[model samples]
Target: MDNIDQIVDARGLACPMPIVKLSQAMTGMEVGQTVEVTATDHSFVPDIEAWCRKTGHQLIEVNEAEEEIKAYVKKTK
Candidate 1:
């Protein structure tokens, strides 16, 4: 992602902590800004998707590879 405003590396973090960090990053961002989050927890894929749906934020991309998952999210509200 070219214009990513912030990057949250939650690679080692588990469960809610990764999501927690992502949420914190979002709060500091402006609308249309984006945050890149990487987490090791496999379950985080669905969790992040659900979060985007609940928050009304835009989930740009999510890719899982090499035992890691990378997600790009943009703050729309």
Candidate 2:
């Protein structure tokens, strides 16, 4: 999407690491700011969905390419 405030490249990282790095990156962001995360883990979709639900963040979109899964999340909390 447009106007993304931060991007977390979690490619090559496994389950928890991708989420962990995403969380860390989101920690410094302000409310309404958007963070785009690119990960290679197949579990990132569900993991990030659950995380967004639990943390009150808005999961804007998720895109899967040949080698990566990209997720756009907006900080709401």
Candidate 3:
């Protein structure tokens, strides 16, 4: 929350949309910059983690609520 450089609001989106937005946001982000993505998809948590691992980014944290999930990713490369 404090150090996040971008917030991608993918709350209403379905599968893969949130990840798409996050990937796009990462395109122009500087190394070490962070992006927060909020989504309604429960699968977003694991999706983001896998994405981070595949992309070589850092998965800072993930917070999930009843209605939504939030993921923080930091660009590492």
Candidate 4:
């Protein structure tokens, strides 16, 4: 997909929504592909990171805006 990574805006989504979308997005990606997921659920920050760790995906970057968080993750599938 080159630089065309998937973007999942989980911005008002609940706990598992963000992570579930991320998992779904990674399904068709290459091993080194990336996905950008944005969420407004602050409590999901650590949860998502921990999920990534357990799944072996790489968490590229995390940016916190005024009311939301942006997480960049690479699919290691």
- TM-scores of the candidates are 0.96, 0.95, 0.95, 0.89
Best by lDDT: 1
What order do candidates take by lDDT, descending? Answer: 1, 2, 3, 4
Segments in model 4 whose C-alpha atoms lie over 4 Å from true places: 1-4
lDDT of 2 at 41: 91
Report backbone clashes per prediction. 0, 0, 0, 0
List residue ranges in candidate 2 displaced over 4 A: none
lDDT of 4 by residue, 10-65 (tens): 98999778888888888978898888889999977897789889999998888878
The better-scoring model by lDDT among 1 and 2 is 1
Residue 34 in model 1: shift from native, Å?
Answer: 0.6
lDDT of predicted model 2? 0.93
Better of 2 and 4 by TM-score: 2
What is the Cα-based lDDT of residue 30 in candidate 1? Answer: 98
RMSD of each: 0.7, 0.7, 0.7, 2.3
Q: Candidate 3: lDDT over CA atoms?
A: 0.92
Tens-digit lDDT string for candidate 2 (18-61)? 99998999899999999999999989988999999999899999
TM-score for predicted model 2 compared with the true structure: 0.95
User: Tens-digit lDDT track for model 3 on 1-77?
Assistant: 78989999999899889999999999999999999999999989889989999999999899999999998999999
Residue pairs in candidate 4 whose N, alpha carbon or C atoms collide under 3 angstroms: none
